[model samples]
Target chain A: MGLEIINTLILLLLVVAALVALRVKDLITASVVFGVYSFLMCLLWAEMGAVDVAFTEATVGAGISTVVLVATIFNLKRKSSD
Target chain B: MKNTSLIPVVLVGFLLFYASTDFPEWGDPQSPASSSPVSSHFIAKTGVDTEVPNMVTAVLADYRGFDTMLETVVVFIAGMAVLAILRNFSRKKPVKRGHEVSVEPDLIVTNTVRLVVPVIQIFSFYVLAHGHVSPGGGFQGGVLMGASFILIALSWDLERALTRFPINRCMVVAALGILLYAGIGVLSMALGGEFLDYAELEKVLPVSREMARYHAMLGVEIGVGFTVTAIMFALYANLSSRGRLEGGL
Candidate 1:
């Protein structure tokens, strides 16, 4: 019951995060928001008892992917795009 | 928001939300995935065969070793492909951009990294070595290990990170990791069993078949960890530096 409610909340947050990440003109800001999106998805997976998947998500999605995105952004100084 | 696009997005969202009602409740024992024969077989015999508490690792590294081996190769191929593309392009045609000044690592960031990097590397090894009982294994551990190097790059510079783990050396280590995996498969085959049949490793190791499988799985996981760690840092190095292998983000 409470768990289901929390799941719904997280899912709602995920949708908002995705939308914001998509609509943002600044790619770097979008990357950071996508990191938030990944972390929320990780939490959702953890709540669903997929701890291994969640762990992978936490590390790869939130940790390494963020670094890669930031590094890529360094190459492109003009962060904003169409 | 524009009405046209907003309508489609909202409609799709509502449809998906409505559809979710028919899905199985969380942790449903009768869920198709949980009730499947393959899952049941793994649950029943994973302990008997591999003596591994973590069935995910046992199944991934032992029961389905071939697929994981191919997956490691895929990671390696990705690193190599990036190298081929970026390294050659830089050599053929050099592109110049506006002036960008290099900045020194922040005092706080460098100091914090100095304190944390050791712990992170140790934790990565723990995740790799303890996967038999824990929720972590090669891929996750490898990512953590790679991140430790990346942290160094972030706090200091790419040159400092490359000094510790050079690009050429990373490639060697990556290949060696794949070799370690394929070598185990070949060894098992030589011991009169099919490829990747870890139970046959008992002939070489002073352990029972089950224990041999357990130990072999650990080795294979380590191989995977090596490849993933190397490829990850390699990718960061090449991409961030535009294959110049000098200045980086």
Candidate 2:
């Protein structure tokens, strides 16, 4: 089904996003990637008919969390210590 | 070290996949969750009891109100904790960093944001008010509202944003939100019903029991929105300024 393909693609991208968020040395890049991961998860939730959860994911997870993370990053070293 | 860690990660990933196989298929009617008496009861009676089209909102703001109240409290406490830890009250000059430079906000960005902020705030209100019939509710709406303020901070500066929404006012608004939620519960209780029994609100409002619940849910959501909006901005303001509450990203 078309829905299943979109879901599968999103899931794959989620994995890539997650891996990139971890692998990236730049904290700002990682935070932005995490936002992408959250948005993909939101799409997955919406696809599965959890609209309320998806909304929360889009707003809190993807939106506010990204801004907050970027704010924190600016106040600290931009690069990962490890 | 990273390569060695990947072994455990891959193993855990496989273990999760193996564990998930035993779970019921998605949306299976015969699944334990789908067939549970509680879910069935909610699905069957939520409309009758609350007159709310959105069952998720009904369950969150009415059925599980106590839990949501505490969740709001948790958000408030987290903001307070961050403030306590990071807020700088000592009278000392901030050391100028290499990156710290006075710069004016970009004209194009400010103009674009000026046009966008009002729409975002109004949309957030729509999301909050229309939650009973739609997918959104307090948390999503409140986050959107807070983000509007953060956008102002981003486009302009923290001082300009704070001038609109002062830090002390933020705390007052956050606590008042909890008070409003609990006050409604107490009022319903005072009207000869158990705590948070919104049906008792029928005594005061010229509406039926179900309608009373519907309106009460909206009130509860407003309380949640207030706390979440204020605390969210407060969190960003304090965190970005390292509690000095002046400069921002």
Q: Please, what are the lDDT tens digits per residue for candidate 2 over residues B1-249? A: 759988998999999999998999878999999999999989999999999999999999999999999999998998899999999889998765556565699999999999999999999999999999999988888999999999999889999999999999999999998999999999999999999999999999999999999999999999999999999999999988789898657
Worst 10 residues of 2 chain A by lDDT: A73-82
Q: Candidate 1's residue-wise lDDT over B43-105, tens digit each?
A: 999999899999988888998889999999999999999999877543554444443447778
In candidate 2, stretches whose alpha carbon ends up further than 4 angstroms from where it belongs are A78-82, B1-14
Worst ten-residue run, lDDT, model 2 chain B?
Answer: B94-103
Q: What's model 2's lDDT at A69? A: 95
Candidate 1, A1-82: lDDT as tens digits: 9998999999999999999999898889999999999999999999988888999999999669988888778777633331
lDDT of 1 at B154: 81
- TM-scores, chain B, all models: 0.88, 0.95
**Global CA lDDT computed for model 1:** 0.90
Q: After superposition, how far is residue A49 of candidate 2 from its true place, in Å?
A: 0.6
